[model samples]
Each structure stands twice: as C-alpha cells, then as structure tokens.
Target chain A: MEDIWKGLMHAGALLFGGDPGVWEIIGLSLRVSGLAVVLATAVGVPLGYVLGSRKFRGRTFIQVIVNTGMGLPPVVAGLIVYMFLSRSGPIAAFATDVLNWWDPAAAPHDAPRLLFTVGAMLVAQVIISCPLVIGVTAAAVGSVPLEMRLQARSLGATSWHEALLTITEARRGVMAAIVAGFGGIISEVGAVMLVGGNIEHSTRVMTTAIVLETQKGNFDVALALGIILIGMAFVINNGLTALQQSGSRYER
Target chain B: MSADARAGKSEPIIVAENLTVRYRKRTVLDVERFELYEGETHAVLGPSGSGKSTLLRVLGLLEKPATGRIWIDGAQAGSADREARLMMAAVFQNPYLFKGTVAENVAYGLKLRGVSAREREDRVDAALARVGLEGTQRHSALQLSGGEAQRVALARALVLEPRILLLDEPLSYLDPLIKRKLVADFSEILTTSGVSAIYVTHDQDEAMVVADRVSIMHEGRFVRSGTVDDVMGLPTDPWVADFIGMETALDGEIVDTEEGIARIMVGGQIIYACSMFCPGQKVLVGIRPEDVMLFAAQSEVPVSSARNRLTMRVEAIEPRGALVRVALRRDGLRLASSISRASLRDLDLEPGDDVTVLFKATAVHVAAAQGVPSRL
Candidate 1:
C-alpha cells in the first residue's frame, strides 16, 4: 500500500513537473487522436447525411454495415493493420526492416514496433469509433420533419442551404453524436494498446498508459490515468446533456 | 379594389391542366383539370385526406407531379424552376415557422427573393400590420396561438407579394371567431391587393360565402366546378345534392290554385309549396330547412309574399341555438321546417300544437337532382 502511494506521487510529479518527454508523449497522443477524428468526421458525416436524407438502393444494407462496425473489436483492426503495414509483408517495403512481417499465420507481435508509433494508434482509434459517429448522426438528422424540408425548399432554399439549416436545427443530436464519438476513441483499450505497443514516452495515451502501468504493477499510476479517463467521460456526458436540453425547446 | 372588376369577373389567371400525381405507383391526385380565375377566391372543397393537400402541394411546386401541367401568370411553368417557385406562395395547414422571431418568419420569403436587410425588415413590419398583428417583431413564432400562427404564415407568404397565394386549409386550427376574423382579414387583403388566391376548405357555407367559384373535389377528381350558386342550386350529381343538404324529394303535380301561386301535393297531403310551375304540369319540389318557416295555431305575422302558409300540428321541435327545427304533420304528411328561437318564443310553440307554416315561392328551389323523376 505504501509502495502504491509512493508510486502515485512519483507519477504525478513526472506528469506535471519533472520530465518534458512525458508532456511530449501527451502532445503526440492529442495530435494523433485529433487528426484521426477529423479525417473520420470528414468522410463519415457526409455519408451519414446522405444516408439519412436521400433514398436509394441498398441503404438498409449499408446501414447494417455501419451498425455492425459500431461493435467491431478493436484488436481485430490492430491485427489487420499489423499484417498490412508490416515489413516483408504485402506493404512491408514501406516499413522498417526491424518488423518481422512476412507470415500472416504468426501472432500480432511478428509484425513489428510499427505499433510503437502514434500513427498506428490513431488508425486503430478511428477504425474503432467512426461507425458510432455515423450511426448517431444519421439518426439525429433523420428526425428533422419532412414538412420543414419541403417548406424550406418551396421557399427557394437550395439543397445545400437546406442541409445547413437542418444541422442548425438538430444541433443537440449532432452534439450528442460528437460527444459519443469522442468518448469512444478516448476510452478505447484493445486497439490502442495492441497497435500503440504501450511504449512509456512514445505511443502511450492515457488509455495505453493505464494498461502499461498495470502490467508493470504500478497500481497508482494506472489508477490515476483511469480516474482521469472516467472523469473525461463524465464531463463529455454532462456537456452533451446540457446542450440537448438547451435545444429541446424547438422539438414539438 | 375596383367594383367594376368584381362585378365583371374575367377569365382565370392560373390554370392546372390534367394534373395527375403518383406516389409509388398509386394515384395520389388526378385532377384531370381545374382553373382559378382572376379577382375571385376559388376554393377546393373536400373532406380530409381527399387529395386536396396533394393538389395544393403540386400547384405550389413543392412536389413534382407525375404527369400534368400548370400555367401561372400567363407563363408556361414546365421549363422554368426559378420563375415558378417565385410565382406562388403557400401557407400549410400547420404553419411551418422557423425557430426565430415573428419578424424573421415574415422576412424569410423576402430574403430568399434577394431583398436587402433594410427593405426586408420594412416589408415584414408592413405585412405583420396587414395581418392585424402589429408590433410583434421580436415575438417568438412558436409562442403564437393558432390564429396568430396562421397570420404569421400569411405574413411570411404575403411579404413577397407573389402573383398567386395558395392556402391549404389555413383556418382549420382556428376557433370560429378567429376564423371569421381571419376570413375578414383575407377579404380585406383580397380587396385591397390584387393578388389572386386558391383556398382549400371543408366548410360548405364558408366556401359559399367567401369564394366566387367553389369546386368540389372527390375520389381523385373534381365532380362539380362552377359558381357557388350554380353548384348549390343545380348540382350535377346525386352525391352533390346529398352533400349540399338536399334532404327530401317528393313527387307532385303543379296546380295553379291561387292567382299567382302554385301548390305541390306529395303523398296526398297539400304541401302548398310556392312555385311558378305551369298549371297542370308535373314538377319536382326541393326545399331546404332554413327556407321553410313554421308558425303554431295562428300566424300573427302579416301574410305577405309568403305564398305557402298552412296550419299544421308540431310533432317535434329541435332547438339548435340560433335556429330551431320544427317538424310538423299536416293532413297525414310529415313536413319539417326551420324557424328561429325568437319566432318560436313569439309563437309560444310546443309539440302537438297546430301551426301555420309559411314559405316563399322563389325561395323554394326546383331540381331534378336524384333518381326521383324529372317531373313530380
């Protein structure tokens, strides 16, 4: 117990004051996650809007794909990326030769320390979470009444303007989707840990750091990051609830 | 605003020709043909879910018709999207208002038409005042009552001053007094402004009172379309006759019993209906409840211009506030008449008391509506 407390203090001091390398790792984590979320949103939000607003063949089938992706195991994505990006494998020439990437039958570690990079972890988080964003956004935008849509169009609004107005009207639902998507990536474990390689000052976000600390028997450090992760989740949920309530006035 | 224009009504400004619309292989609206003339309030009267709204939507260009054509303001609407959308403005049954101030709602159409902010605000204020809701610039649109919401919708459409005003049951959500005021406001606007309008409603009397031409739409087509008097007085179909309160049809031979009066005897009872049918010629008799007047025992009112007045025993009196329906029997034939509560109270009328029924000859119409023979 005393060792746990002592380890906690050391980790806290290292996080806040002592080493610039820890802050660098945190910065890398934010950069990678931010880049991934932005890319996914750019591709997914338009897809969701199209699915919700337009009608065509295979829509339900595509919706099924989105729903299935929402529960996709993160480790599976990490393994797939490991095989595809590893040295001596399908795209091996692009990776470092240090990776043992030739055989698909081997375990995930046979791929390489490409997993030790921040980009790999970003890919994993985006893969694990983008489906949730698309699904929630589709549901949100679909709730806009068809009457209002027709009314706006007849009043001379172009199609793009109609889409913009709908987004403004359904702000609460879209906000909730964003928060849910953020929570998904920020708290993800299997994909981040597997693809991130859990290096102390390289690929470790708060999620991966917690996993690594637990492995090293540093209960205090792991517990501290866990608390922070849960706190972030709490803030996001409350913020979304506030926004939804604020926008509920127009919902007839 | 010119009395000359109102009196000498001209041809229709807008015409919908063969406007058939299909939704997923089912015919939603099949108008075949209908037109709206200038300086006239043309009403599309139909029951609920009777394609009235679909026709409005197609006319307003909110939805494309599967097959049809619409010509507005003397321009063919087939090739022009921009001009067509600008030509007409519609107010839906449930007014579609934005989450904004009343002023913003009214200014939506003007803004779409490229009006500057200054001009938009001015026009919005003027439109609001015209709709009898002045100084409500900042009021939230959703906070408005049913009547106020409709006014805001009209204000939104009227701000642009489109050539055609299309309304889909605008007064459905309003109370009677509010509806009357809204109608009056519409009349004032129509009189003051030259904008033509197409109104859709279910109220028969309201259609008669407000519209210059009332078109009855049913079963994917309009069965009767003409002036209010023409449709009501000479209905083309038995369904229309039933729709317009034509209750009983009795067969009788017209007889010139008096100097300038004729009587109809139905089922051997002398139903002395006032008419100018040729003597000894058979004719059908039609009487609406409101046109028939009843009096008990002695009709103290001076007998003048009432060609048909007879003593009958009151079988029943059903009071419906402003009017009381008195059903009576005279010479073994049951006759029903409508009288005012004031008249009933003045006559001290009750059931089983003999009364004199008075009805004018010109007021009682003749028609070969249903299958009850052309000459009775």
Candidate 2:
C-alpha cells in the first residue's frame, strides 16, 4: 500500500509536470489509434449499412463472417498484419517496390521497412477494430424501421437520399459503433506491441511504455501511464455517451 | 392538342392494368384493372390482410407488382422512377417521423427537392396550419401525441404538394374522438386541396364519410366498386352486403312476382321485395338493420304501410353506441335489428319474448344467388 501510494504520487507528478517522453508516448498512442478508428469507421459504416439493408445471395454468409471477425483475437490480427507486411509476404512488395517508386526518399535503398513502424501498428489496430465497427453499425442500420425507408422513398427521396436519411436516423448507433471501435483499439496492447515492435522513443505507445517501464522496475511511471490511458478513454467515452443520450431523445 | 396533353387531361391520374403482387408464391394482390381519376378520393375498404394496403403500395410506387403496367399522370412509370414517385406522397397507419422538430420533418421533402431554407420554412408553416397544427412547427415530432404526430405526418406530405396522396389507414391508430375530429379535418383538406388520393381503411363508416368512390376488396380482389352510395346501398354480392354492415342477408326463394314486386318465402314466411324476379328463383334478400322496426307481440297491430311482419323470439340484445342490436331468431333464421336503446326499453322485451319485426317492402334488396353458397 505504501509503495502504491508513492507510485501514485510519482505518476501524478509525471502527468502534471509535462514529461515530454510520457506525453510523446501518449500522443503517439492517440495518433495511431485515432487514425485507425477513423479509417475503419469511414470504410466500415457504409459497408455495414449496405450489408444490413440489402438482400442478396451470400448476405447471411457475409454477416456470419463479420460476426466471427468481431470476436477475432487481437494477437491473431497482429500476426496476420505482421506476416503481410514482412519481407517474404505478398503485400511486402508494395512497401518494397511500389512505395519506393511512389516516394524514394521515404523508402531509401529501395527497402520500405514497415514492420516496426507506426503505419504497421495502425494497420494492426484497424484490423482489430474494423470488425467491431462493422458489426455494431450493421446492427444499428438494421434497427432503423423499414417504414422509414419507404416513407422517404414515397417523399421523392432517391436511393442515395433514402440511404442518407436512414443513416441520419441511425446516427446514435453509428456513433456508438465508432466509439466502440476507438475504445477497442485505444486500450489494446497485444496488437500494437506485436506489430509496432515497441521501439524506444519511436514506436512505444502508452500501453507498450507501461509494459516496458514495469519490466524495468519503473513502477511509478508505469502506474502514471496506466492512469493517463484510463483517463483518456473515460474522457472520450463520456463525450460519446453524452452524444448518444442526446440522440436518444429523438428516438420515439 | 398533342397526344400527351390530351392524355394528361382526359386519362385518369393513375391506371393499373393486370397488376398482380405475389409474396412467397402466394398472391397478395390481383387487381385486373383499376383507375383513379384526378382530384378524387378513392377508398379501398377491406379487412386486415385483404390486400387493400398492398394495392395502395403498388399504386403509391412503393411496391412493384409482379406483372403490371402503371400509368402515373398519363406516363408509364418504371419501378424506380424518381419522377413518377415525386408525383405522389403517402401517409402510413403509424406516423413515422424522423428525428427532428415538426417543422424539419415537414420540410424534409422540400429540402430533398433543393428548396431554399426560407421557402421551406414558409411552406412548412403553411402546411402545419393546413393540418390545424400551426404552432407545433418547433415541437419535437417524436414527442407528439398520436393525433398530433399523424397531423405532422400529413403536414409533411402536404408541403410537397404532390399530384396524388396515398393514405393507408392513417386515422386507424387514433382514439374515437380524435379520429372524428381528424376525419372532419381530412374531409375539408381533401376537398380544398383537390389532390387525387387513394385512401385505404377497414371501416365502412370511414369509407362512406371520406370517399367519393369506394372499392370493397376481399381476398386480393375487388368485390364491388362504385360511388359511395352505390356500393353501400346496392352491394351486388352478399359478401359485400355483409362486409359493409349496412344490411342483414337472408336466403329466400321467390314464390310469386306481380306488378314489379317479388314475393319471397323465407323460413315459412312470405316477405315482400320491391324488385322484379322470376318465380322459383333462389335469391339473397338484404334488409338494413335500421329498417327493421320491432314491437311487442301483444301490442295491437300498428296501422301503417309496412308490408312485411314476422314474429321473432328475442335471443340477445347488445348495446352498440347510441343504439341497441337486438338479435331475433325465428325458426333458426336469425336477424339483427338495430334500434334506439330507449325504444328497446319501451318495448320491455327480454330473452325468449316474442316480438314482431316489421319492415317496408322496398327495404328488402334482392340479388340473384348465383355465387352465394347455400350455407352463407
């Protein structure tokens, strides 16, 4: 208990004293997770809406695959992304050959190594979070009454316009989906640690840094990082919850 | 005039030919031919699952029939024709309002049409006023009472000013008082706007009150279609007569015909019908419940011009809103008579008490019992 008290005090000092290293780790964590979640949402929301609202052959099969993907282990996603970005993998040629042509400076010596980089971490997190967004968003879009779509169409809304109306009506569920995706990736450590390589001062995020500090017997800093991560998650979730609740007022 | 212009003026606003809608291999709607004149309210009256709503959906362009050619405002309409759809609007049984203020809900269609915000607001306000919800523009649409929400839905469709409106049991979800008020309001709106409408409902009274023309649908097919009085007062089929609740049907055989009057034998009693029929013809006789007058069996025979009287034993009496439904049985032939509750008490009749059921000879409507089964 005494040691915990000291660690808490030390963690508070690190937070308030503007420790650049800790702040950088927090910033990197936010950047990677934020980009991953944004990208995933941008792609997943429409895909989910289409998957949910339309009826076609293999729709049930696709839904089953998406539901299964929602429960995919983070380490499995990380491993898949790792193998894909490795030197001997199929997608590695894009990083090695295509990226070199696209930007030689960024890919010096014709070798675009992405295995231990922020981009690799972003890919892993996106893989880990996208299925969650898809599953939740699909359910949300499905929950919108079919009458609404027919009403919109009867009111002269084209297919695209009706889709937009449906999405607007389901805004709360979509927001929840995005927030869930953000939460899933922000607090995740396995995928980031595996794909990001947790390089010191480069790829080390809050969760990876906590693991490193704990292993090095730097309990105070580890505890501080843990508190900051939780605080960040709480703040984001609070804002999203407020938004969802406000939207619910119109759900009659 | 050009052919198109002539068609626009002379042709019906909607014409559906050979329309058949099927679901899961079962036919849901099978309209052979139908038309809706411009600026007329045509009510499709039927019971639940009777394909009235399905017909409305097909006409509203919300559902495509399995095989049909639908002409909208004299133009052939494809399944997903935006122009065709824009020419009409619909109000469902339950008012489905989007998540917004009433004004925003009403303005949604205009907004989709790229109307300016100022014009949208003005039209929304005017439409709300038309529905008697003038000041509810800023109210939350989702929080409205049932009637108020339905009015907003009407406002939403009204603002669009479509050439046609499709109402599917729009007032069926409201309480009786509110329904009455809305019905009156809707009647006025329909008359003043002169928008061609197809109103679907199960209530015969509602159809009579709102419809300029009515089509009685049963089992995916129209049993009768004509002007309101024509269909209600002169139903060609026994099922239609029963469905409208306007008359009680009794199976009888014509025994004599003279001077354009047919004397029918019903349950060992002679009932006079004021319609020409050949002797020995099997017919279905319909007597309006309100036309049947009841009197105590012991009372002196009233000096009146009513031609037919049968002494029937009272079986049951039921109160039906401002009137009483007295069920009378005579030799297994049952008849329902609707009379004032006060008159029922004046008669002082009870179960098993004999009463004379009297009605005018003209009150009996006779139709050939061609399709009517013997046990109907």
Candidate 3:
C-alpha cells in the first residue's frame, strides 16, 4: 500500500514535471498506436462496409475469418509480422529492394533489418488492431437497417451517396470501432515488446518500459508508467465517449 | 389555362406495360398495362400479399421487374436512371426517418440534390407547414409519436417536390384515431398539391375516400380498374365482389330473363337480378350488406316494392359500430344484412330468429361462371 502511494506520487510528478525520458516514451507509444489505428481504420472501415452491406457468395466464410481474426492473440500476430519481415521472408526482400533505391546508404547491406524496429512494432500493432476495427465497424454498418439505404436511394442518393449517409448514421459505432482499435493496440505489450525489441530512446514505449522497469525491481517507475498508460487510455476514451454520446442523443 | 388544365395537357406521368415481377418461382406482380395520368391519385387496392405493394415498388422504380418497359414523363426509364428515380418519392408503411432533427430529416433530400441552404430551409419549412407540423422543425425525429413520425416522413418526401409520390400503406401503422385524422389531412394535401400519386393499400374505405380512380388487384393481376364508383359498385368478377365486402354471393343458374331482369335459380329459390344474362347461363349473384334490409317476419312485408323478399333464419348477429351485422341462412343460401342497431333492437332480432330479408333486384350484381369459382 505504501509503495503504491509513493508510486502514484512519482507518477504524477513525472507527468507534470516535464520529464524528458518519460515524455519520450509516452510520445513513442502514442505515435506507434496512433499510426497503426489510423491505417487500420483506413483499410478496415471500407472493407467492413462492403462486407456488411453486400451479399455475395463466400461472405459468411469471410465473416467467419474476420470474426476469428478479431480475437487473434497478440503474440501470434507479433510472431507472424516478425517472420514476414525477417531476412529470409518474402516481404523483407521486396522492402529491401525498394529501400535500396530510395536510400542506398541507409539500407542494410547483408540482410533485411526491419526486425526490432519501430516500423516492425507498427506493423504488428496494425495487424493486432485491424481485425477488431473491421469486426466492430461491420457490425455497426450492418445494424443500420436496409430500409434507410433504400429511403436514401429513393431520395436520389447514388450508391456512393447512400454509403456516405449510412456511415454518417452509424457514426457512433464507427467511432467506437476506432477507439477500440486504439485501445487494443495501446494496451498491447506482447506484440510491441517482441517486435520493438524495447530499445531505449529508439523503440521503447510506456508499456514496454513498465515491463523492463518491473523486471529490474524499479517498482516505483514501473507503477508510474502503468499509471501514465491508464491515464492516456482514459483521456482518449473519454473524448471518444463524449463524441459517441452526443451522436446518440437523436438515435432511435 | 389553370394549372390543372395545363397538367391535363401534359403527357401521362407514368406508363408501364408487360410489367412482371417474380420472387423465386412465384410471380408477385404481373400487370399487363397500367397508366397514371398527371394530377391524379390512383389507388391500387388489394388484400395483403395481393401484389399491390410489389406493383407500387416497381412503379416507384425502387424494384426492377422481371420484364417491363416504363416510361416516365415520356422518357424510357431503365433501372439505373437516376433522373427518372429522382422524379418520384415513396413513403413506406413504417415511418423510416433517419436519425436527426425533424428539420434535418426533411432537408436531407434537398441537401442531396445540392439545393442552396436558404432554399432547403424554405422548402423544409413549407413542407412541414403543409403536413400540419409547422413548429416541429427542431424536434428530434426519434422522439415523435407514430403519427408525428409519419408526418415527418411525408414532409421529407414533399420537400423534394417530386413529380409523383408513391405511398405503400402509409396509414396502416397508425392508430385508428390518428389514421382518421391523417386521412383527412392527406386528402387535403393531395388535392392542394395536385401531385400525381399511386396510393397502395388494403383498406377499401381508404381507397374509396382518397382515390379518384381505384384498381382492384388479385392474384398478381388487376381484376378491375375504373372510377371508384365503377369499380366498387360494379365489380366484374366474383372475387372482386367478395373482396369489396359484398355480403352475399350465390351460385345460380339463369332460369328466365325479360327486359334486362334475369330470374335466377339459387338453392331452389327464384331471385330476380337487374342484369342481362342469357337463360340457362351459370352466374354468381352478389348483394352488398348495406343493400339488404331486414324486417320482422310476422310484420307486413314493406309497402314499397322490393323484388326479392325471403324468410331467413338468423344464424349469427354481431355488433359492428353503430350497426348490427345479421348473418342469415335459408336452405344453405347465406346472406348478411347490416342494419342500424335501433332497427335491430326494434325488431328484437337475435341469433336463431326468423327474419325477412329484402333487397331490390338492381342490388344483385351478376358475373359469369368461369371467374366466379375462384372466389368460392
């Protein structure tokens, strides 16, 4: 109990006292998770809308795959991204060839070296969060009755316009999907720890730093990092909740 | 010329031929030919699943028929013709309003069309006022009652100022009191706007009250289409007669005819009908419940001349609003008579009472035999 109180005090001071190291870790965490969620939203939302609105053969099969992917283990995702970006992997060779043309001096000469890097962590986080976005967003779009779409079309909306109207009507659920994706990746430790390699000043994030600090018996710093991570999640989710609630005031 | 005269000079708003719609292997709508003229309210009336709604959808361009050609305002309308579809608006049975304020919901179609904000607001306000919802612009659509929600839906569509409006059982979801009120309001709106409309419903009363022309649909095809009185008063088929709630339909053979009065033999009883039919022709006889009068069997037969008067045993009596529906049977021939409750009480009629059923010969409508079997 005493240790927890002392840890809380230290966590508050770290947050308010302009601690450069703590801020850097927090910034890296936000950047990786933020980029991952943005990319995931860009890819997943449209895929989800198509999956939810259209009727085609193999749709159920694809839905089953997505539903399964929603619950995919983070460590397994990390393992897949790690293997794909490794020296002998197909993607690594393609990426190496592409990077070589862009910046030959900066490119690795011996092998693809994406492993244990911020980009690798980002890839893993995207993989971990994208399915969640797709699954939730699909549900959100599906929950909007088909009659609404028909009404819009009857009112002179093109198919694209109808899709926009449906998305606007389902804004609350879509916002929730983005928030869930962000939360999923930010709180995730396994994938980022495995792929990021937890390098200080380069790939270290709050979650990974907490793990490192706790292992090193630096309980106060570890607890502070935990507190900061929770605070960050609460702040983000609070804003999203406010948005969602405001949208629901007129919902039937 | 007045606007109504100008509208009359314009081409018909809609024309459909060989329109056939099928679901799976079952045909749902198979109208050979249909037309909607400018500034007219045409009703397609039928029971549930009689394909009235399917026909409405096809006409509204919301559903593509299996095979058909539709011309809207003299232009061929393919399934994907946005301009053709934009010329019409539809309100379904349920008031499916998008989540928004009433003003926003009503302005949605205008916004989609890129109408200026000032014009959209003006149109929205006018539409709301037309529907008698003048002050409900800023109200949340979700907070509306059933009737109010439906009115907002109407405002939404009316704001578009479409050339034609399609209504599918629009009042069927409302409470009776609300439906009554809306019926009057909607009738006034339709008349004042003079927008061509296709109103589809199963309620005959609604059809009669709201439509200048009524089409009776049965089994995926129109059985009768004409002015309301022509279709209701002179149904061409027994099924339509029965559907329009004629109380008695009897299978009979024409025994004799003179001067357009045919005496028919029904259940060993001779009945006169004021219709021309060849002797020995098989026919179905129909009489409306309101056309049948009842009197105490012991009382002197009415002084006025009624061609058909027969003693009947009352089988059942049911109270219906201000009237009592008395079901009568005689030698397996059954008839229903709707008489005022005061007369019912004056006669002291009850189930199993002997009563006299009187109807004029002209009240009996006769249809040929082949199409009459389906009604039975």
The most accurate candidate by DockQ is 2
Deviation from native of the Cα of residue B362 in model 2, angstroms: 7.8
Cα lDDT of model 2 by residue, B210-312, tens digit = 8888899999998888677557655666688667654345678989888877789877678897877778878877677788899899888788889888899
List runs of model 2 lying over 4 Å from the truth: A94-111, A248-252, B1-10, B246-287, B298-336, B340-376
Query: In order, what DockQ does each candidate have?
Result: 0.35, 0.70, 0.69
Flag the better candidate by TM-score, 1 or 3: 3
Instruction: Quantify how close model 1 is to the true structure by its C-alpha RMSD in Å.
Output: 6.4
Tens digits of per-residue lDDT for model 3 on B237-316? Answer: 66886677554357789898888888998877888888677787888666778888998999987586789999999998
Residue B309's C-alpha lDDT in candidate 2?
Answer: 83
lDDT, ranked from best to worst:
3, 2, 1
Per-prediction TM-score to the true structure, in the order listed = 0.78, 0.86, 0.85
For model 2 chain B, give the 10-residue run with minimal summed lDDT: B1-10
> All candidates' lDDT scores?
0.73, 0.86, 0.87
> What is model 3's interface RMSD?
1.3
Position A252, candidate 3: lDDT: 61
Task: Tell me how many residue pairs clash in candidate 1.
Answer: 5
Instruction: List the candidate 3 regions with Cα displacement exceeding 4 Å.
Output: A96-112, B1-12, B17-33, B217-226, B234-242, B247-286, B300-324, B327-335, B340-354, B358-376
Q: Which lDDT tens digits does candidate 3 get at residues A153-209?
A: 888888899889888888888898899889889999998888889999999998899
What is the DockQ of the complex in model 3?
Answer: 0.69
